[model samples]
Target: MTAAVSSAALPALLGPHCTVDPDRLRRYEIPERGEPGKASGLVVPQTEAEVASLLATCSKNGVKLVISAGRTGLVEAQRPDGEVVLSLEKLDQPLSFATPDGEVFRFGERAAPAAHADALAAWWRGIGAPPCEDAVLEVQAGMAVDAVNLLLAPLNLMWPMEMGSSSAASVGGCIANASAGANAVCYGTAAHLAIQAFGYSGDGREVLSDAPAWKAVPEDLLAINSAQPRPEWGLIGTQGVLGVITRAKIRAYAIPGQREAALIPVSDMPAAMRIHAAARALFGDDVEEFEFIGKPALELVRDLKGDAFRSPLARHDAPYYLLLQVKSHKAHIDLAGMLYEFLADAVSLPEDQIGYAPLKALKEIRHSITEASNARMRALGGGRLSFDTATPVAVFGDYLKVLEAELKAEYPDMALIAFGHAGVGGAHLHILGSKDAPVARHAKALVKIVFDVTQDFGGTFSAEHGVGTKWGDEFIARAPAEVRAALIAAKRRHDPAGTLSPRSFALDRQLAG
Candidate 1:
């Protein structure tokens, strides 16, 4: 391999796009969780051409590049380790909207992109325009998720992939990680929403998903792609190992006209599962979100946020809580009445235990779990273990029960706080230990126990969170032999020099091994 490029030499080679400033480099190194890493330099590319040129230079020189956008990743994918940081923050612009037939709605007419959802909504209402049908938004990968929604709100549409860090999570990062949030049960994951992608391979070759004939294709890209099959939508989950995604066309959905949510106290996981089934049977596709929050997680939020964040239920004694929401785009549908009827007739939940809440309020309580858990971990001053795992919906309840039992039996002292998108059979499980009873010493063993249970329940250890450096070994060990070979081949094919995101999923180490 060629010698790695030095940070000092970057500015001379790439001009103003590259920076060796320590302060800016430090900002790109911070991850949502875990220790920060060190970067040799930071490069902020403003256009697709610049991104292509930068990748070409890095590939030729054997310089590693870690793609960073928003810097809200929890798996340390954005955390550079002596590699150059490619920040896409400056590429935050929504290009346009188009229908399948090629009708385009360019943003050039507007002075700037929509900044607030409320203002956009008011403007859209004033126009009295019908919602755009079969709409797809072509947006820069660096655009924040919330900003995308803000732009869509005016059109009575939404990207629909919701996350707690929507304000900070970028379009490309979500696509790279194939993230599925609370609304995933209805709208599905990023892979499903992203229909097209345009980017550059690690070797600096322009890559594009099959663009319709109406869309203009770069002459050079077309010439280069004459022989190779275009990358499929599955590229959404490659985690940047295959290529760097600069822009994508994401599918949009009509905003629900009527929505209602409720927090129902449950005695245990089984009860939550039963309620979830009842809701699905009652409302079908209208069940937009169903979240599970363990008692410990709920208690943590209350303790951290004080009385203002206390449980809405009259009695906060339930061992678990299920946040259920139903929505429909049809204006005539009585979503509120349906939800109340489901709770009263199907689940038989008592009035006192059923807490009817606004959709925004329910979301606040659900999203606060992560912050509250992090705060509790810091206070304890011990090792922190956070897992994003998923199981088959049929066995989700049993999976949680088995996992919880194993944790209690193996490490009784470690505090457990579990919550996540129950509608999609995914859970965010956290283990916190006090300094006096640190779990760091047995971190490996604890992880093994959890993975084993997940496997037994036909679940994935790395669900929404991609296989960053944190779970690379687990992926290598657990992936089928054919799957490993395919990934290795793709790495060699797209990133021959191992220049882009060499540290992601430890592909560099895997290649060497």
Candidate 2:
């Protein structure tokens, strides 16, 4: 049964509203686990003082705590194992703005521009919430992400975070998981977006907020970044274990007036690489996205999404089709034209043949194709596989070849889909259909094979996705001995109790005592 913290530790702090609710316990459970339940019990604290008091109580009472956000995490950060969850659900706020003397609150700590954006995102996407001018918004840890994005529409502002599960994810949840999405190539991830945050130790006795520690971040992020390490605040990837983020400020961008999307003909591998090279040179950071799907992927997109799925290659015999987009009128049309020229010159593919479908239709094509492909793969029964990895941007084509060769050698019968942001060198390599052989043996062996190749290439095992519970052993096994030790030491110094998602990594050796 799920239980709350000991009354003896700090009964005065809890009062009446703090008592654990019976139904709330079920909310924390991993519904996917069903019978083999993981997390249970949840604590809802309305204020930072309450959060601190809760943590202090939990620590004093020898209890472990896991921060719960939107619960949409794919790697299962919130996948609990009977821990008492500190649900930031109650920490909600209304829309307020940051004018010169902007609205500020002394909740856990004053929110920053970064946190304001995150709250803004969560506001638009949640419930009846809609974005208002100079909106000052705050969120509890558990608000769903889609709910937040929905609210953002009215304000003409948008959170850069765009995950597949955004409809059900939370702003705070995405940050807690340090999440990323397909659009990350252009915008980066949660870590980059988060500007300021307030963190508290399990016992609430310890508190950390970047607001006080963080010096002013510039409207020109580049200028601020040039100074390196923002003289004031510590990095945030290690924030959770270092301290729990109760509230945060995040980076946000103006909503694009209209998006331009098209499919360009990539005649061959070299031609595809050239397009990316030229595109990057011209668009620089504004290049929202550029991904190449092999002929096989396009065939799938066509077969699954039907005739609406058109590509620049009319014959469907080309080597690849690159998904292209030019976001906002602020984007340079000349750059897009240059990219078109690069593709045409590199591989004699005429620009006319590399025609584009408009942005609105392009949206349907991408969304429809991806969803359909996923459905088709799952429908075949249960053996669909996926591997996401990163390689250096220049050697991306070479990396794709290596990945294809290795996978083909292992399972000739399966279908492989090469999709993801080539700009970031991260590709989603999906394996559709199962091999005639056993999955665990083949799948595990395949992962090992790919992991070794990636490591050899000086590429990281994880680019966007952090090493969670499932990847712990693999992550430790992959890292150099010293690196692992340093990570462990850091975690201990920040969280000596192993309180923040204790199983995040296997720290039993250093933290076991």
Best by lDDT: 1
CA lDDT, every model vs. true structure: 0.79, 0.57
- Report the Cα lDDT for candidate 1: 0.79
lDDT per residue as tens, model 1, 1-513 = 124666788788766988889987777778878898888888899798999998888888778888889888777878887888889988888877665566565555223455434444554566555566578888899989998987887677889888899998999888776787888777677766787878999988988753222222121121111011123433467788888889998887888888888998887887788887788878887888888999999999889889687556877788889988888777787778877888887888778777997777778889998899989998998878988888767678888988899999989999999998877788899999899988788899999999999878777787787777888788778866777777778888888999877876678889999
Best by TM-score: 1
For candidate 2, give the lDDT of residue 125. Answer: 55
Q: Write the per-residue lDDT of candidate 2 for residues 1-513, one digit (tens) a residue.
A: 124444333234444444345465666766321122354456677776777766666655566666666554434456667666666766643234332234343333445434655664454455443333334344544445555455455567666676556666656656644455656566665655555655675445454444322222221121111101121233245425445766666544667655655677665655677777776665666667766667776677678756556544457676666776656544445544655565567546565766666555554555554566666665665365555676666666777777678878877777777666665666666666653443444677777877777666556555554555555666567766765666677666656666667766555443663
> Residue 177 in candidate 1 has what lDDT?
69
lDDT of candidate 2?
A: 0.57
